[model samples]
Target: MKKFVIFSVVFLSLILAPILFTILSPVILFSKDNVIREFEKNFNTRLPKSTVSEKIYDDYGGFHNDGMKLYKFVFTAEGKKSFVSYIQKQKSWKNLPLSQAYQALIYGGEVKDFSGNITGFGGFAKEVGLPKISKGFWKAIGDRSVVTARFIDYENLDTKTLINLKSFDFYLAIYDTEKGVLYMLKVNT
Candidate 1:
């Protein structure tokens, strides 16, 4: 009886251990380093040593949880070509001028009067744990910019419609062509 019980326990352990690891691997392995690698793999571009990255927020480690990741990469001319090629293949990207990009992203398509008082109020930064980047930073960006997004609850990237969503999964990528810089953000809530 002892022998049978011991064998049964060992067999169960062998089967269950792998299952447990499979479920827990993401929680255990998700880190800044892994995020960088995932970025390179997903974008099919290598980030140079000078690339600046920050984990603006993280609540739960796994993909299913609420968290945010932000990356800024400055690429050489050659690197830019490779990245652009990859981006061009992607569908549903919107090319926006600097001003519109700022309005849509920072202000969540809020309307402002000439005096610059916000007539409409909705923003993604505060909702997704992103810090308020200075308007000067947006102003300094070159004229040509591209924005693309995916959200769980939001059907489309329309600014006004998205304004009222309290919490949802969000992924946004902005590429500044003139500066060869790319900013990628992912928020899951």
Candidate 2:
């Protein structure tokens, strides 16, 4: 019986090895390049070919959460049309841009690895045992602009299943009478 059980365990391990590797492969090969590629793939769909009006400045780190990195971007752009369209698509995003900064953390569309989750990044948090996140902010750069935000959440897709999503990603949209630009941030916890 002992020998039979040992054989069974080894057989099960052999059978499951590839499956486990498939699931873990993303992490072993994790890189910012992958995250950026994945992000652009998803983002371009929402704001296709929105051109940048000014130079973009990016800041990244593991400061906010241990074992998790966060990315923050500050820039100017001419994506008003696309940004407004996205705001319209979001349920929690407010209609008035100057009145208030709106926010939500739902699972959003169809994530590559997570199947067809509809709720956006916030819902993903619920699935992985964290409080839902709300990441929007009032205008810091320009008082006239309303700084809106979305949690990209996909920044850490490689580790999405293993880590918390709420602390890992965010996108902020800031707009005023002159122009608009989206601030994209990614993090992990």
Candidate 3:
């Protein structure tokens, strides 16, 4: 009986391995149109078509097989305040106090790990009235702010928004008193 069980288990493992890998771990393929589609599909809202944006792909882990691609769109709103004001109106997103929000984010969202640091200014930093780049925009990946919990664990709408912040990728989007824009960010795992 022991021999039979062992053989059965081994046989099953060998047979299922290929199928499991192919289904569980898939190579993701996408584009701007795909991004808009995915964003709309996931968020249940239309991704605004008017923004100027592009797709960025970075080869990761020193291998072509390990890579990630994401999208970025700069708004025509002109300043941090305008951008923030626009996004604030999104009911799906909740703005949290940046300093305190980091520690609380891990418990509520689909994101397993989130961390970030203030990096520097965007190209529009000067035009946006940023005197110091770091103080204006924080450059970070795995951003903790502007985060939207993408992974849904329960069907309840409350559960989906239990966290106070909303970010699809939480790519940095900070605007200060002068509407100084500071945020450079991207992350996926």
Candidate 4:
């Protein structure tokens, strides 16, 4: 009986530990202030005295119990609109104006290896929905002259059960206000 109890305890620990760790890791690692600080540190070039314009929690989808907090920043640079965000669950930092740095992490294929099963584009597309993500979606997103980006949670696609939508992978959108161009970044996560 003692041996059986010990084995069960060990098995439970092995299985549940990671699950628990994944869920709780974000709370332990990052706080709202930490995210704010990281954003300031990364985007300080444009935003010398980064001020938090807004802070709000948004549900990207129904994937995880904890949602993401979006941070908006108003930079001091002329003709430059920018912001920064952090995904608590993913523990990632993203600075805006959607530069190459942001692309590298979101769609550059590096995020997949870093976060494992947690993907940037996949989470984005799922949350934004398919109708809003058509071919010309990029143009529309860019027309706004205001660029907002965030790493919020969203639903995961069940590839095994569906085949027609198999081509669908991940979603990312960036709009250049001055250039009047919208850029879409997609990757297989």
Candidate 5:
């Protein structure tokens, strides 16, 4: 009886140790500012010097089992606008266009507009002021378009990091004067 109890205890401890670590580990250590640093390092883009605005909202389990805490930052650079976020619960980061973030900032209240195709896939388009122009107009400009960087977890939800990590997907719709062209850029890092 004593041997059986000892064996059970040891087996249970071994199984539960990793689970406990996963649950207790911080999902995200980066904040809105940290996201800017990462973006600069990876993309070679510079953020505006002016103070960027940020708001935190709950994801309601949209991105993960424990749900996500989204931080939205708004700023303008080179006469263009942009936004970025650090998804705490999802352990990922995102950069959005200024217009989309503004729209959500204004009418959407605190709720975020997530893409149906993927849980954490969505971003803002550059603000063009006019209705029709802002919808997808950035794609029309040779220089502007909606861009998204996504990180997905492919393993058991209980695990701290997803297994079988996939390549990152960056999407952009470039608009020439006559028509719009969609471009998908896949990169592995």
Candidate 6:
């Protein structure tokens, strides 16, 4: 009877160990640290302690392999300088056009004026659940800021590729040199 009990205990432990580990491990563990880790892993960069504000929405389960992982980091002057320096060093990143930025980041539902001018910035703030940017946000940063971006799992980045994407993984970093504000976005779907 004791031998049977011992065997049963061993069998249960063997079966439950992995399940517990999967539940306990940091892979699916949602926290600020995990958000930072995921961002660092993909962008090959680090976050500074001078962060002003950050919003992270990570629903990507490790084994489940679904849902979106979104992170937005708003940094102080010192942090912006530090991050911008890092981005400037990377060869993969390119200067993103303002029109493309509007389309990609904003997605859809924009309000335009009679002269074919964009009166409203669009639907990303409401739809994607990211932090909201003011109407003047793009215009304020457009000239002074350095907007750089790079796409993951894509060989060529074009209008068609950006439009036809069913799944995406990419990074965009904008540094307002004058305001000393840095905005970094990492999206995986």
Q: Cα lDDT of model 1 overall? A: 0.53
What is the TM-score of each predicted model, taking all chains together?
0.48, 0.28, 0.33, 0.25, 0.25, 0.49
Each model's number of backbone clashes? 0, 12, 7, 1, 0, 0
RMSD per prediction, one decimal?
A: 8.5, 17.4, 15.0, 16.6, 16.8, 8.5
Q: Rank by lDDT, descending?
A: 1, 6, 3, 2, 4, 5
Q: Model 4, residue 132: what's the lDDT?
A: 24
**Model 5 lDDT tens row, 24-91:** 66544434566555444543345456535243343333322222222333444421333222121222
Compared with the true structure, what per-residue lDDT tens digits does model 3 show for residues 74-174?
Answer: 44545444655555576544343232232123212132222432222122223322133223222222323223333432112232232432322333333
Cα miss at 85, model 1 (Å)? 2.9
Better of 3 and 6 by lDDT: 6
Residue pairs with colliding backbones in model 1 are none
Candidate 6 pairs with clashing backbones: none
After superposition of all CA atoms, the RMSD between model 2 and the true structure is: 17.4
Model 1, 65-132: lDDT tens per residue? 54655656566677777766766665534454334434555446655445556545455556545444
Q: Alpha-carbon error at 110 in model 3, in Å?
A: 20
Best by TM-score: 6
Candidate 5 clashing pairs, residues 3+ apart or interchain: none
lDDT of the structure predicted as candidate 4: 0.35
Q: Lowest-scoring 10 consecutive residues by lDDT in candidate 4?
A: 137-146
lDDT of predicted model 2: 0.37
Taking all chains together, the TM-score of candidate 2 against the true structure is: 0.28
lDDT of each: 0.53, 0.37, 0.38, 0.35, 0.31, 0.50
For TM-score, candidate 1 versus 4, the one ahead is 1
User: Model 4: runs farther than 4 Å from truth?
Assistant: 26-30, 43-189
TM-score of 3: 0.33
In terms of lDDT, the best-performing candidate is: 1
